[model samples]
Target: MRKEVPLLITILTAFIVILAFFLTPLAQTQQILLRWYAIIGGFAMFVGVWNLLKKHVFQVSRGKNTFYSLVLVLGFFMTFAFGIYSIVKYKDAFYINSPFMFNFNYVLAPLQSTMFSLLAFFMASAAFRAFRIRRLEAALLLFAASIVMLGRVPAGYALWHKLPLIAEWIMKIPSMAVQRGIGIGITLGAVGMSLRIILGIERPYLR
Candidate 1:
């Protein structure tokens, strides 16, 4: 009964959302449903936080990567504490120079940026293998990638006068055209998936 109820609700909601586009009167109904969706999503965030804390605390108790797990649990509590303090002290208006803001901007923000900066090196290594000139297509891709990568820098301009112009033309024309084609493909796939879900053929959430 529980599964059947959810499946029926899913089909009804999907149909209503689809109908809202052609039937103007259903648009307000769609907006109300969307707001309910937002409310449910807010609650879902707490569920996720609970799950994360449970997993990390379990790891800490089991002594599996205890240091990292303990750090995660401690960090979560410290962040939550400062965040609540900031909210109460500032009356829902967090200032730029607040303790929570300082921790986020200086500590967490730099850590995140450094992590992403390290990832760029790994990406470059992977790109080098993918951009190998083993075939005509690969060679062309390598050339295009080289031009695009270089043209954004001042050194590329110093190297050749027309290199940046060629790069700009390639990006604005061929790259944009390819992106539009991919977007259309993605839109079609999304429509197909939506139809499958509405028809009860793709019951992924049930699993």
Candidate 2:
């Protein structure tokens, strides 16, 4: 009975959402569902914070990577406190020069940039492995990657007048075709998963 109730709710919600796309009458119901979604999302965030606190606190107590866990716990609380203070002071969490925004701009953004900068070395390593001239496909990939990299620079144009034109053609034609194919595949997978949930064949929440 517990599983049946949630399954029925899922099916009904899916129906209303699909109907709202084509029927004007159910659009308001869809908007109501979206509001419920936001409310549920707020509750989910609170649950996640609680779980994070529990996990990190246990890890800190058990002396398992205690330093990192302590750092995470302290960072979360500091960020939360900054957010609360900013909201109380200016009624806006991200007002310019607020402590929260300061942390975001200085601490978060730099960390994010550093993380992506580190990824460049890993990506270069992977590309080197993938671009090795072993098969026809790998040779073609190496050729395309070389052309695209060179085309973006002024020296390539100085060396060969047609470099930029060929690079643009490869990007617009073959690259775009592959992108579209992958996108279609992703969309179809999403649709299939949605249908499975609506039909009660996959009960993820119950698990």
Candidate 3:
């Protein structure tokens, strides 16, 4: 009965939202339900934090990857403490940008940039291997990529006047068409999946 009730509510809510889009009479109801959704989502965030705290604390206590677990736990608690301190100091519940923001900007931002820089090098190495002229498709892709890269720079215009135009044509025609086709496919797939969930044929939420 518990499972059945949740499934029924899910289906009913899905239909109500969909109908509200097309029927003006249910618009207010949809807005109220959306507020309920936001409230539930806010509560879910605390549940997630609780779970993360438990996992990290357990790891630290058991001495399994103790250093990493301790670091993670300290980072989490420090951030939380700073956030609370900021709110109280400013007397604004939603106010951001304090010691916490400084830590994020100075400490985390550079680390993230470094990680992304390393990722770019790895991606370039991968592209070099894949772009080798081993097959017809690979050859064409390499040619197109080279043109786009070169044409976006000043050197391509100095080297060849027509290179930029060709790059633009390739991007605007072939690239745009492929993107549109992929977007349509994704939209159709999402619609099918949503319908399955709304009909209660797919119960992924139960798992």
Candidate 4:
């Protein structure tokens, strides 16, 4: 009975949601359902927060990487507290002007940027290692890659005037064709999946 009841509710909810999207007269009903979804999602966040705190606290208590765990907990609590304080105390100012934004801009932003900047260096190193003029295909691939990279950069245009033109042709023709083909394939696959779900053939929610 428990299983059957939940299955019935799920089917009914899916039917109502589909109807809400297609049937224009049920706009008010759709709004009500959306409000219910929002309320449920808000309550679910409390569960998420509890789970996160429990995991970090357990790690710290076990003394396994306790220092990092403590840092994680401190960061989480500090952000939460600052958010609450900003909302409750300074109702007029934007949250971006709060302590959260200050920490994010001065500390987190620079750290994140630095981490991602390392990826460019890694890519250059990997390209240098992988690129070899041993075979015709490998030589062609390396040449094309180098041309594309050079065409995009200022130094490439300064060194050779024809590079930008060749790069533009490659990007506009071959690259666009490949992109369109992939997009069409993805669209068809999504349509097939949606049809399967709508026809009750794909029952991922069922255990």
Best by TM-score: 2
TM-score-superior candidate, 1 or 2:
2
Kindly report which residue stretches of model 1 are placed more than 4 angstroms away from their true locations once superposed: none
lDDT, candidate 2, 38-95, per-residue tens: 9999999999989999999999999999999999999999999999999999899999
TM-score of 2: 0.90
* lDDT ranking from best candidate downward: 2, 1, 3, 4
Candidate 3 ranges beyond 4 A from true positions:
92-97
- lDDT of candidate 1 over 1-82, digit per residue (tens): 8788999999999999999999999999999999999999999999999999999999999999999999999999988888
Overall lDDT per candidate, in order of appearance: 0.91, 0.94, 0.90, 0.82
Per-residue CA lDDT of model 3 for 3-42, tens digit only, reads 8999999999999999999999999999999999999999
Per-prediction TM-score, please? Answer: 0.88, 0.90, 0.88, 0.77
Query: lDDT (0-100) at residue 159 of candidate 4?
Result: 94
What are the clashing pairs of model 2? none
Q: Candidate 4 at 133: error in angstroms?
A: 11
Model 2 misplaced regions, further than 4 Å: 87-91, 204-207
Residue 109 of model 1: what lDDT? 97
lDDT of model 2, residue 103: 89
**Of the candidates shown, which would achieve the greatest lDDT relative to the real structure?**
2
